[model samples]
Target: MNGTICQSINQSINQSINQSINQSINQSINQSINQSINQSLSLLQVMEQV
Candidate 1:
C-alpha cells in the first residue's frame, strides 16, 4: 500500500513537471518563429521597395 501511494505521488510530480516544461518550450518556439517570420517579411518588403 505504501509503495503504491509513493509511486502515484511520484507520477503526479513528474506529470506536472513535464507539463510546465513543454509549455515553456512551446512558448519560446512560437516566439522565435514569429520573430523570424516578421524579420523575413520586413526584409522582403525592403527588397521590393529597393
Candidate 2:
C-alpha cells in the first residue's frame, strides 16, 4: 500500500513537471508569433511610405 502511494505521488510530480515544460514552450511560441507580426507590420508601414 505504501508503495502504491509513493508511485502515485511520483506520477503527480512527473505530470506537474511536464505541464510546466509545455507551458514554457507555448509561451515561447506565442512570443515568437507576436514578434513576427510586429515585424510584418513594420514592413508594411515602410512600404506605404514609398
Candidate 3:
C-alpha cells in the first residue's frame, strides 16, 4: 500500500516536470519566431528607404 502511494506521487512529480519543460521549450520557440519577424520587418523598411 505504501509503495503504491509512493509510486503515484512519483508519477505526478514526473508529469509536472515534463509539463514545465514543454512550456519552456514552447516559449523559447515563440520568442525565436518573434525575433525573426522583427528582423524581417526591419530589413523591409531599410529596403524601402533605399
Candidate 4:
C-alpha cells in the first residue's frame, strides 16, 4: 500500500514536469514559426514593390 502511494505521487510529479517542458517547447516553436512567416511576407512585399 505504501509503495503504491509513492508511485502515484511520483507519477503526478513526472507528469507535471513533462507538461511544463512541453509547453515551453511548444511556445518557442510557435514563436519561431510566426517570425518566419512574418519575415517571408515582408520579403514578398518588398519584392513586389521592387
- Write down the TM-score of every candidate: 0.86, 0.85, 0.79, 0.93
Mark the 10 consecutive residues where model 4 has the least summed lDDT. Answer: 1-10
What TM-score, to 2 decimals, does candidate 3 have?
A: 0.79
Native-vs-model 4 lDDT? 1.00
Off by over 4 Å in 1: none
- Extract clashing residue pairs from model 1: none
Error of 3 at 13 (Å): 0.2
Report the lDDT tens digits of candidate 4 across residue range 1-50: 99999999999999999999999999999999999999999999999999
Cα-based lDDT for every prediction:
1.00, 1.00, 1.00, 1.00
How does residue 20 of candidate 3 score in lDDT? Answer: 100
Question: To one decimal, what is the Cα RMSD in angstroms of model 3 from the true structure?
Answer: 1.2
Return the TM-score for candidate 1, rounded to 2 decimals. Answer: 0.86
Model 1 sits at a Cα RMSD from the real structure of 0.9
Q: How many collisions between residues are there in candidate 1?
A: 0
Error of 4 at 20 (Å): 0.2
Predict model 1's lDDT versus the native: 1.00
- Candidate 2 lDDT by residue in tens digits, 11-34: 999999999999999999999999
lDDT of 3 at 39: 100
Poorest stretch of ten by lDDT in candidate 1: 1-10
